[model samples]
Target: MFYLTVDILGTISFAISGVLVAMDKKLDVFGVFIIAFVTAVGGGTLRDILIGNTPVGWMQDPIYVFVIFGAVIFGILFRKRLKYFRKSLFLFDTIGIGLYTMVGVEKGLSAGLLPIMCIALGTMTASFGGVIRDILCNEIPVIFRKEIYATACILGGASYFLLRKLPIEDIYAYIGAILIVIGIRLFAVVFKVSLPNIYKVEQ
Candidate 1:
């Protein structure tokens, strides 16, 4: 039940983020839906395939489809209000990554993966959706940038494992890890913090 809730929340967040981006690009209605659908499930689909979970997760569960559809509709209707928020896309994307990271981590744990592999899966799960969305939108994927995007997921996944060693409940640990990811991302963006640049500037 908890997993289902988290997955749905993540789906909604990513779907809304996709909608915002597509709308910003002035895409048609069908294009907007496509972007939302892919952005919501692309990562999970890839993760499931990599883990040999055939047919993927969104296919097995029609609820994800319905949830994304609803999210798209919500985004369209409240677009003016969303635009008023200005940073709505960033907000949803951050939330989506945080929730999806834990969802992937949980799946990795269920698959009996090693800690490092679990963290990798978690980072992939939190990132690939946005990657696909950005590619489709013709923008550079955030994960490929010097921003602390995937790093946040790695740290958060590591924190989850560390928390599991404590006496806390799994649910608390899970939520804590999600918050850590979100917090790190928010801190990085708000404070202009990023990975060190490697390219030399031509004077």
Candidate 2:
């Protein structure tokens, strides 16, 4: 039940993020839906394929598609309001990635993967959708840039692993992981924290 809720919320959040990006790019209705759908499911699809899960996740459950459609409609209807709350949209995207990181870690554990692999999977699941969306929008992938994006996912996955070793219940551990990812992202954004760029050429 927890997993399902997180998955649904994450999908909706990513879908809305995609809608905002599409609108910013002045994409058509079909293009908006396409970007929304891909942004919502691309990460999970890649994760499932890497884990050898046949049919992928969104394909197995049509609810994901419906959620994306609903999110697109909401974005279209409330675009003006959304424009005033771009930061809120970013918050939603952050929460989506946090929840997605947890889901990915759990799925990786179920797949008998190692801790490091699980963390990698979690990061990929949390960030790959945005990568796909950016590519489609002709922008650089945010995850690849000097931002605390994938690093947050990695930290969240690591925190989940550490918390599982404690005496607390698994639910608490999951919540902690989610909070860590979201909090890190929020803190980074608020403080303008970013990874140092190492590839600067002489101007």
Candidate 3:
């Protein structure tokens, strides 16, 4: 149930995020839906393929497709109002990554992967959709920027393993890990903090 909830919410959030970018680019309806669909499912598709989950998650379950359609419709209907709520959209995106990271980590563990591989899978699941979205929209993917984007996913995945060592229920640990990702992301955005650039060329 928890996984289902996370999957739906993350799908909707990413779909809407892609819609916003598509609208900003003045894309047509077909283009908008295409962008939204890929943004919502691309990461999970890649993760499932890497883990040898045949047909992928979205292919096996059509709920993700329906959710993205709903999100695209909602975005289009509320386009004007949504322009004023970019922060809210960002919040949803942050929450999406947090929740999806946990879902991905669980999938990895179920696939008999090691802890480190699980963490990498979790991070990939959380960030690659945004990467695809940005690429399609002709922008630099946030994951490649100096912002603490994908790093939050990694921290959350690490937290999942760390919390598992405790005596609490696994769900609690999962929720705590999600909170860590969201909190770190929110903190970075609120404080305008980003990772420093490591390379500079003198002209």
Candidate 4:
């Protein structure tokens, strides 16, 4: 049930995200579809392969494919209403990160992975697809330099595990994780919060 919700949200967010980027590039219908597919499935595909989940998650669950297509169509049709592209990206990315991170942690826990690996798993689940999408698009990924992106996912995953160890139920833990990710992201964006640039340091 929880996984179902995350799948829907993650696919929708990624599809919209990909479409918005496509629109920026003036991509045609086929181009939009390809971008949406990569953004929506890349991360989950990587995570599944790393975890040795045969057939991969999206391959086994056909609904996710349909959902991505539907989301892309909806994004195209409503592209005008989604006038504020940057705002939409921020909002959906925040949500997508939260949902993806939570489910990744859950999957890791189910697989009996340690908490540290779960943190890595959660980050991969939330951000790697965007990484791949950007790479394919011949650009740097936004999260690589922008706001408190991937770190928010990682921190929220760690926080979720910590909270779960307490008396909280699984649902509450999920909610807490989502909220923390969202809060951190929004706060970072609004306040211009950013991580240190290790590479740009003086030689």
lDDT for each residue of candidate 2 in 105-151, tens digit (9 for 90 to 100): 98899999999999999999999998999999999997787789999
Scanning candidate 3 in windows of ten residues, the lowest lDDT window is 194-203
Q: For residues 102-154, write the lDDT of model 4, one tens digit per residue.
A: 87887888889999998888889988888888887788897787668899998
Q: Where in model 4 is the C-alpha error above 4 Å?
A: 1-6, 84-89, 199-203
TM-scores of all predicted structures: 0.86, 0.91, 0.91, 0.88
**1-203: candidate 1 lDDT, tens digit per residue:** 86566667778888888898899899999999999998889988888988988889888878988999999998899988886755766776787789889988988988999999899899989988889999999999867777899999999999999999999999899999999999999999899899865564433
Q: List the residue pairs that clash in candidate 1.
A: none
Give the Cα lDDT of each candidate: 0.87, 0.90, 0.88, 0.84
- Cα distance off (Å), candidate 1, residue 109: 1.9
Error of 1 at 154 (Å): 0.7
Query: C-alpha displacement of 181 in model 4, angstroms?
Result: 1.1
Worst 10 residues of 2 by lDDT: 194-203
What range of 10 consecutive residues in model 1 has the weakest lDDT sum? Answer: 194-203
Best by lDDT: 2
Superposed model 3: Cα runs more than 4 Å off: 1-3, 200-203
User: Cα deviation in Å at residue 39, candidate 4?
Assistant: 0.9
